[model samples]
Target: MRSLSLSNLLRHHKHTAFGHDDSHLPRQVIEVAIDDSEDTHELPARKRRGRAQSTAGTIKGVIRRASLSLKGMVHVHRRPSVTAEPSDLNQQLPNGRPTSAHHTWNRLRHAAPFRRSRSVYGLNGTEDGLYEQQQLDHQMPIPAMGDEPPYIPMNTGAAAKASVALQNEYYNRQAMHTQWLQSASEDSNDRESGIGIVVTEPFMESGVSDDGSMLGQDSNISRIDFIKELPSELAIHVLAYLDAAALAKASVVSRHWNEVVRNQHIWRESCLREMTTTYATSEPVQPGAGLGIPEIAPSKNWRQIYRAKAELAQKWKEGKACPMYLNGHTDSIYCLQFDEYKIVSGSRDKTIRIWDMQTLECRLVIGPPEVVNAPNVLEDAEGNPTHYVNLSDSYKAAPSKPQVASFAEHHKASILCLQYDDEIMVTGSSDSTCIVYDVRNGYRPIRRLTHHTAAVLDLAFDDKHIVTCSKDISICVWDRATGALLRQLRGHTGPVNAVQMRGNTIVSCSGDFRVKLWNIDTGRNIREFVGHTKGLACSQFSEDGRYVASAGNDKVIRIWDANTGECVREMRAHDNLVRSLHIDSVSGRLISGSYDTDIKVWDMETGRQLLYFPRWHASWVLSAKSDYRRIVSTGQDPKILIMDFGADVENIEMLKSANTGIGGIRL
Candidate 1:
């Protein structure tokens, strides 16, 4: 009987295999036989007419068990056949069929739950309501395992309300999930697009924690403080973009930034950069054969090369004022004079220094004598006081000394003024005397005029006339040939400080604040140009004799039309008082020296300052004079400076030769 049952099972399994290949048939058949044996005794019996029900039930049970076993085996073995070569599974579906893998997955997901609850809910008949009911079901709590519950249809009453609520919640959850996915996609898109927008989103989201309060509060504070603490260098970088006026104001905001902007090099570089950019496109540089080609044939002397370089440098600095450095004095220079041959400077150092005009080098320095009476003290054989007699006789018999004496130690006071004619030089001093010296000889004093009660401040000369002004408010006119006082002009209420002679008109400036024009022959004031507001320090007539320029303690230099007495032009000449004035006849250039230690030249025609020679003295620039080609300035620095407006080439060459190779001497 068992054999029959097994054979029957084999037959049923074979029939269920359908079109499966027989290569795996033995394994399937063995599995089915084992399954049938395990359940053989427990199977229900089959019933037959008039047979005992127990036996019949047993038979039926055995048949049913065998049948189920055969079915399970067939299902396992009935896989579609695979050929040795891969199958061409690229077959087309029927027209109008959903074709993609994605479509298939979606359709399967929707159909799974619908198929499960179709009968219990009658969902198959109501297609539209089926989706709504499914949505409701998703919201309900899940049932425990193995509990098969009936589908509950959504309705229009309380169940409808519950259903609507459930539908809303389900949709809301779906929308939230969808939104989250969309945001994540957008964030990824932003990152990939390099927009930089979404990069900070994580930080923004994290800024507020789960409790909705800011995280890392102290860190945020610190970050804010850090931003506020940006360095001044950064501030300056920002300010650099501002306009010049605005930038200038910003420099005052802080000391550090002020220092940066004040640097001249920065401004210079900025100017260069701006100029380069501004002209770069419009201006094309002319091509050069080489850096510098000699227009003249090259010479063997390197001096030629140096000379060319210096010439180029001078041309570059043309129209610009240059500094003149002078050194060759031992005491304050009291007088300065220059001619074609040499520059002569007299100093209280009791020396007269002579500088070669062409070479601009000191040629000689004449110092004071050790003794003034050595020649006269010589003995005549007997050793008696040979020339000694009465005081008047001794004075007359004494050998004459050098008139142009350097009474450096002998004089108790400073020399105030110096004047020279062809053969004689007369020096006025604070010692109340005018000493006349024969300059052609060894500086022997020809005579001494001692009538002045106070220091002699100024001296002037004509062919046979000698005029001197003194602090005694007096002017003494002396006969130059006889060394005798010719006349005295004494109307000035204060010290007569300066004297000038133009033909017969003797012009004098005084501390009395007036320029008194006098007729030298009559020794009487013809007219007084009296508009000056301060003590007159200097006065000079124009070369044309039409105007007189006077300057004083008021710091203004006024030019008066000498004939009309009309103020022509008033120049605010210096920061300090004007100490001296000299007009160059050839150039019509007015030179003024000031207590500010500056020598300024002005064009008389335009009344414009032409050149400013600054710091010409460490103290007051006491005097300045110009002869068109050169300017000579004397100051309290005890030095005389000779400035050449011509032949700077030679000067530059000399300077270069002195500075270079070998002995390291500078001319």
Candidate 2:
């Protein structure tokens, strides 16, 4: 009887272990227990049934051992369903314990035979375990109860093949990248074209687009993108070597390229390299000039500066400008100095006038000490007035202010030349004297230097000394503060027309048809630049002191190496005498003003004429000066024509009509 009872109990337990219905459980829990990975596993039905039977036996043994030998045996029981809802059944517990179905499912899931199959995959002839893992990796997660199961991929066979292809592709890509890095490391020039690696993938192929833009939709990845990926400093260093034209072209490559190209320091370097000769490093800041204007700032962005100057230069070359006539002087304008704000012009009328740049009104008139009207107006050999005639103005305008100060007692003759820095101004006169005025202290004459026997023709000064060249065929270097002559240089046989002093060097051009470089302190002629057949009217040392540019009565402009005294380039600039010359060191532009009334701009490097302003002045252009922004020229005409290269005047027809002689513009 005992044996029969044990046998019956064992049989009941065996049926309960594998035969109990799990249909009432929630769908999600059922799917988790036997996910699609299990379904896709291609095991024969007999094999699956055998494994299930073995799992049930193992659970039965575990339960029997627990009931007989363990101190606390755990048993699961289920309560009667409340609404026949599978979700409700999942939530409920029998006798306040885990459900029997959950316990049985877990026991069957972790059975020794089932675990062994999963642990060792594809070693034998079956695709059950390995296939399950690959499918699970790509499978959709199971849905909760009341939700339909998503389309779970059961492509175990296909996934296995794809896994092998993916491994092969990854290894091949790695090898290609390694080779590229090795080659790039060996030769740095290879990296300039950007790093390239040919990655061949079975799913992707390379192709081109219609617009020439890189269209890397699937394959054919562009290596140019790697340049954008470089660190900004390194990328800028690489691009710094490109000239302005190349850099401008590169800016249009892409949005990222444009953004990188606008970096401030990059343009700053280029500006310093190309425009160093023209832009002043130590110009003083003027009042009312720097109100949020970048050009007047202490450390302005070089890109903005370069663009403004380039545009102005283009306009100057084009001759697209309207004339502004400043009418105040009663005689020919002899010498002038100007900046952006004001034009200070001296005339043979025995007066100096300071004109406002914007309004064209004479701000202040500086006459001689006592107003003396000549009994007879001087006449030329042809009976025409030797002095200039005032340009006819239909509209009459008054001076803005009366003469600020008159020094008729100090200067007996016309003011020939003048220059001023921040603290002082020096003026040379036909009275054979030079006057140093204290600009910081009410513009009063501080020193009256008298030594020259003939009229002072031109003068140059620094803080320490004043250099004066005269019709007496001599040059005088004087101590500016003491009004004492320091050294007298007697070299030119004819009157010296122009002189420029830079540091210890003084360069003078004379009517003797010679240009000389001298040491101002020692009174020694450093070198003589001799090539012109006619008298040299103007000369200037370049900003770097490497070259000297001079123009003369011969109507030719010559550039000489200051060190070698070699005539490097010569160009016939004007039909008449070339009276004045200015070297725009920042732009490498040589500006020549001529008695022919033409103001021409030339390329200093090639001696090629860049622009020809025919009849820029109504009469002989006596003196001209320029800053980066504008050019102010004075002539035998009473009006001081301010040719504002900065002006935005556009006239294509005027530019075409201006070319008269000199083979047109070189570029």
Candidate 3:
């Protein structure tokens, strides 16, 4: 029970009564305690009287490590019974043989990780017939790959037949140990230190000393920590291959290994190389790249950072999240977008609602000014005046609905699409028009662009131009500052469903089964991407505007090269039409919502479906967006579902710049 170091234990083990000459031999004695109730009748002669002539005179139950005698079979020497003949010993009844020895050797044999094959130890042979008897002393078959040295010994001897008893004795002792384990398996630890043996099972497994022996005290061989002896830089390089789990195990090997595991070099490799998302602490910064902001914490702990990333990645991989519902929308939500502070959604109910991120309350609502602010329902409210009890409280009437609503300045039809930045907010409607408002100026109306003759299905804008696609088979571009119609891009035979603008490039997908690229300034059709067999519903430009991704009624997402019009990647997973697709380049992930009522996440680069969320909406999913911490989606079920995957991470704001596109998960 004492806390002793390996050095003190080895010192005591070395000073055991063996003389200098005997101690120089290869094998040393290990003391094994014999169970009191052990049956000695089955064994040849089970008692040791006096080793006065030998070195074991002071110890009572000391047994030498099993060795091969002169015969080809193992010849174990036990108590010297003067009455028993060598030949008669073989005929002795096999009843009550010590199974403890068999259990130990069998355990060590199967457990040695194959340092020595069963053939070398005659383990494959029975007590009746020694099939692969050891003829040479200590010599074994060559070590196999991934196995280490200090090969376990096998039977040896041609002169001695009954002496094959050493292996049997070893087998006998191990058998009893196996019996003890079985009977005491119900113990809390499943360990039988009830005998007070100093060598516990874990100690025997992990406590090997310098020479790879049970106790290297008596052996003349010297061993050193070659890993520690390596140059410090090389040591870090070697430790890099051991992942987080292996590194944890290696840390306790010694103080040297612990320090190496704690070194910044080790964790820096994990954060920069192993992690998919870039850590703010290690990422390189470029001018005007504000996202490359440093961590808010004064000092960084690389190890803690890696641990956090690993845990969060696992949560995403497992599709683990907590859900919060926004239940205001009365009809199918056609389009929505959000930043870190609030969520804005437009629905078929002819209203646009703004929800606060923290309070989850609708802060503002925009609807038609001429119509009464009342929900259109088939329910007979007059007949329901005498309503009875409902199925549950959840089916009861609404208790707290928004009291005030703002009338839309221009939209007379359903608000279908919207986008916003710091300066202005833009909303497109089935009225075939787009209304721009000062986002920071109390939602003040800026101007209206009514160039399209049909429903404005989708819209995208940058600093220079507002791009809108329509059901009238037209794509219109307007100056953001002047409200001037810049270009009327028309090429598709069918109505364009989605449009995205980035710098000089504009990408659009139409119901005519074509995805096209355009030069915003000249209104020239740069290229057309041809892949989908059915109408396309959505399209977007990559961060660099070099690649385009589109999805639609075909239920597949295709990525294309803008310059060559070549289909570069196709992601196929959804069973029904994929209605929406959003590419987050920072995280390198594609967020998808399907008409099958599912929202799925994909690795854009690998085209692998990392995972999908469980069904939370009863109707078609219309839109979905994801960041590092959360994924927000809406459906025809008229519910807004916000699932927060990284809700537990405290400093999650650090991940705002880079995306988790390559984040690894267990799936």
lDDT of 2 by residue, 567-629 (tens): 999898889989889887656778889989998888888999987778867799998776555
Poorest lDDT segment (10 consecutive residues) of candidate 3: 64-73
Off by over 4 Å in 3: 1-296, 299-305, 369-408, 569-576, 586-588, 603-608, 612-615, 647-667
Better of 1 and 3 by lDDT: 3
Q: Which sequence of candidate numbers ranks them by TM-score, best first?
A: 3, 2, 1
Model 3 Cα lDDT, one tens digit per residue, 321-406: 87767766668888888765567888887777766654565556667654324543212345331111121325532222333345
Cα lDDT listed for each candidate: 0.55, 0.60, 0.61
Error of 2 at 281 (Å): 11
At residue 20, give the lDDT of candidate 3.
17
Give the least accurate 10-residue stretch of model 2, judged by summed lDDT.
114-123
Better of 1 and 2 by TM-score: 2
Give the winner by TM-score: 2 or 3: 3
Model 1 regions lying over 4 Å from their true place: 1-326, 360-412, 649-667
Error of 2 at 226 (Å): 5.3
Measured with C-alpha atoms, the lDDT of residue 368 in candidate 3 is 68
